[model samples]
Target: MAAERGRPRLARDTIVGWMVLVLFVSLLSVVIVVRESLHVSVTERANADVTQEIEEFRTFTRTGVDPETSRPFTTAERLLTVYLSRQRPGSGEVIVGYVGESGVVTTSYGAGAPDVDEYDLTRDPAVLRAAEQGTSGTLDTPAGEMRWARTVVDVRGGDDAMLLVAVFTGEGTAEADRTVRMLTLVSLGTLLLAGVISWLVAGRILRPVRQVQEAAAEITEHDLTRRITVGDDDVSGLAATFNRMLDRLEEAFRAEQRFVDDAGHELRTPITVIRGHLELMDDDPASREVTMRIVTQELDRMSRIVTDLLALAKADRPDFVRLGEEVDLPALTISLEAKVSALADRSWRLAHVAEGTARLDTQRVTQAVLQLAHNAVQHTADGDAITLSSDVVVDPDLGPALTISVADTGPGVPVAEREHIFERFAHGEPPDGRRHSGAGLGLSIVRAIAEGHGGRVDVGGTPGEGAVFTLVLPTHTPASHDHPEQT
Candidate 1:
């Protein structure tokens, strides 16, 4: 069930859907605010125009009085009644009324106007203020309510009569309402169109990301050579970096495979020798002696191979153990010269001496030196001169290094074969025409030990001349002892 659910989905579509949702919400909020503001502005302008017309009419009544009879041409109620009756049009109405100082016995105009008792002019603060100040007052009137605006004008006569102008103010509100409804419809349509366009644009932008994800999903250890194809643009650089990472992984994988194969091959020979000796032991007592000796030899070889393999593996580890102690190169060379002299038939010389010192793993360093000495001896004639020398050299690139060289009067290594000579299982014919007995891991093991100590081995020779093998290690101060203990 989990595997089935892990199947890849359309990532581009998902991104586009979320983008469109956010855009729709943002655009909708802006449209709502704009529509509301436009409606309010339109209603305010319409109310101002209506109020101005009322003021003009009031001014006419105030100034147009008869000078001879000392009376206005028409009464406030009669003139307002005729004016408002003519002003009534479709979807709107107008009315006129009067309120005296005592707030009673008022006159009204227009047939559709509500009764004066029902219209609470005194209860409304704005209307009451307008009546008291003899000015105009405008109030917001919602639909389904008896709403209006009133203008109070005082007459210019001694009778203290007043003119009151009132209009239903719903016309401007209705027109604004209609405009808002139309704008809302148009905004919703725009939002829909914008959502569709945003989805398409989002899909276009996200398509490359989806393609990269798909290509990544198809990659595996067995098929890491495959790469994502991209255009020669910014996206292509990303692909190139990804491909480089894959290349490193592939190289690491191949190295691991080679290690396994080499290890198996190295172990097989010793196991076969042991098995053959054991199988022959059950047949005869005379053959058992030879078989036992053969078994012992094979066991020794196996021990050497196992030890070398462990050392190589430890060198590769990040936290490989290190035991540092001061060691004298001249003294160590003297000990090795003595041991090699006792073990071989040839004469060994110690020359070009330097009293240099180093902090090193004494036992491992001695083993590496012994291996190089043995290798030189194996390639030399029985009577050839073997020399072990020490010198302290300061190289411009490498700083101070204690150089220990073993030179033998043997056939030298060829130039083409020099690079591969340090690799495992690399053996060539010596000057004496005798080959070494073991798998060619001696030089490889020596190189590993040198590298473990943060040093290196250098080889130089000419054809038919002797080869000089030098082990270079960083120099240090000598310890105040006869000989340091092995690490």
Candidate 2:
């Protein structure tokens, strides 16, 4: 118990933890993918803008005619100066021209614009070398990061020069960063909410399991009445099944208790009879012989009672009847008449024989029929007609059924006693006004055999004329035949 209490609550917290982790991983992946895509998009757009600007410069130089003079330029300085004067850079962009060792042209636009000297590549040897090579890359300046693309141009009668176009990308990158920050905040809030919801939902789902555990803890051998309250969700099926199991357990326990009670009650009479006879026996030989006979008879009666009680107890087992055996109904019925004919001095007759085969436990069916015949013999006098019959009939709910009946020319059972005649220890009186000598479990055993075949036993006949005890069983083999028959 202490170990069980100390164990982790894996069912509750572990489920919640896994849910939160999956949500966190999924949300984080989305954020990372979005951020990377946005950053890549910003860099690509800036690169395209810079490339476009450089391409325009190359296209103008190809014309070889100055836009301002409408004539061919004589020197590279004139060409460079004329182009720089005609240029209009976009927002957050700059245009610079590096002409040999002593000439520089610069233009800037947008807010926080740096002075021309700050971007004058003439002072920076690395920048000038990179620009001269027509390279494309990023550079950190007083105006923040810039993406630059450049091209070197060699014109006749002029110093070698380079044209550089740079786009200020700090604002674009800052916008992307801001978007990621907002997404991160939102995702964190959503994760928090998801964790809370997951915790509650996990608890709700596991509540039934906890109830089953608690109910099991409270239940004992003497008390099997605890049941889980069922709901309509998927988990409710488990609770419903558990309740059904409990119901069967409770019924089995009650049946065991009743069997013990009935055995004690019934066995007391024979024990008292034997004890009384033994106590009253005298020294005379005749008296002693009579007492011994009485004692032996009582002991035999007790043995029969014990056997009947055991049969009744075993009725609830899965293998009470060995089903799936094909037996000819007509032959089985005729054989029943032959077997029961010697039970008493009554007139035993075959009334009808069904002309078909059925899968059933032949031994159990024969045993039930013989018991019915014995019952009929007890109910009627000698020369009274006892009829045995079998037939194939159709039950509306059960399809084809095979019915075997034992009918007697004796008083029929009263309507009031029919309901419980199949119950254990329940009995009906015979016509001779003599108490029955055998245990009352004969009909119960018969009913058990019928039910084991997924069928039923019923009593039907005209009142006071006769009693017809019929066993109605399915003609086809039952699905429960998968269980191996017990020896």
Candidate 3:
């Protein structure tokens, strides 16, 4: 089935791709900016070098005397030759001396000098025009772009001469190219590393979601035990929430199945009894009347069973108990004692009534207490001491609480039955060895009511003495209408 859906794009890949693309663009921008900056700096430095050389030549012409001989230079050729020979140019720099219409007189080259013809300024008319104007500027030549500055020297005894200082830009441009190449290579390597790291980190972050998907796929109506292992991140928190939802769903499904099975089992017995008696009945009026009575009794029993089942089922719903009403505990106890006193002829007496007001569903609490009272009456004879009571108690976990008890001198529940006595259809040993009459749903209803009120009902006391069934309830109202967590 998953194959039919084809392969969906994974979040990890998308995250890595976006990260790499953004990083690539940023690094590319850096490389381009740095390369341009280096180019500008190199061009400025070459122009400065050409200007300085021109200034030095002008200073030499002013002095005129040769530094070696300490005598005035006699001719333009000797003066130009002397200046060219005395100066050492920078890298990619060249100095040329020209006399009169003789064009090129003598030339000097710097380190890493290009081919002699590359910087032959005489061959370029535009350069000659600019030099004639006594201005410094750039022009393209065989050695690439060159920045040049020139000055003319006039000597009293000889032909006039021109001194040109030209600095080629090839070396600086080559260095910038090399730098850009290295930067691009490093940027590519860094991008590759970023992509690899992003893939690993994204996979780790999304692992919990994948596990949740796997767990969901494994779950069904009959199976919901799979769960994702949790962590501290937001993704892990989602997995935790999903696990909690599964827990609720599993409980709901189990309760539904149990209700169906128990309802079928309990209802079948009465149905069979009614059907058998009806089938055997003859035309005799008395026999028909007896059969009809039996059928009616069985139907009533089935109705009670179904009603109890529904009550238990509704206990799981959010609105099972309407809370937020403050009720006087003492007055509630009085009302309960008066009501349960009519259930049987047992001697009903109030042991205690708790003082104070509490927020609770009074109707539900009253029903649970009365259920305990009824159970006590069922196990005892007329005039047996059946005491009803309520009081304030301190629970280790719940803090201040209210306890209501119904104690009766009857056949106490056996030790083995106490654990599951509140379970549906669970019956204790017959009281006084007499067959109990009604369907075994009363105590279960009592338990459901107690739980709905965020309380519990438990039986204690030795066998052959009497059982004390008490409901321990919280004094404060629950925070929500949803069922409280069971202790």
lDDT to native, each model: 0.64, 0.81, 0.83
Q: Pick the candidate with the highest TM-score.
A: 2
Cα misplacement distance, residue 31 of candidate 3 (Å): 2.7
Each model's TM-score, in the order given? 0.61, 0.89, 0.86
Q: Report how far residue 356 has shifted in candidate 1, in Å.
A: 8.8
lDDT of 3: 0.83
lDDT of 2: 0.81
Q: Please provide, for model 1 over 1-487, each residue's C-alpha lDDT reduced to its tens digit, 9 standing for 90 to 100.
A: 3452233235545655676677677767876776677657655654554566566666756665544456575444444444444453222333334534544333433444334465544356666565566555555433223334455555433223344445453545466667767866877787778667866765555444555566567777677676666556654666667777777777667656656766788879989989977975876777888888898998898788777766665555433425466677778778777776765777788877777676767666777788888888887768788898888898554578778788888887766767688887778655545567776778887888777666788888775788888888666422321233333
**Cα miss at 360, model 2 (Å)?**
1.4
- Span of ten consecutive residues with least summed lDDT in model 3: 1-10
Write model 2 residue lDDT over 195-287, tens digit each, in one string: 899888887877777777777778898999899999888987877888999999998998899889989999999999999988888999999
Over 4 Å off, model 3: 4-10, 55-86, 98-106, 117-119, 151-162, 430-435, 477-487
> Candidate 1: which stretches are off by over 4 Å?
1-14, 43-148, 158-224, 227-249, 274-286, 310-371, 381-406, 446-457, 471-487
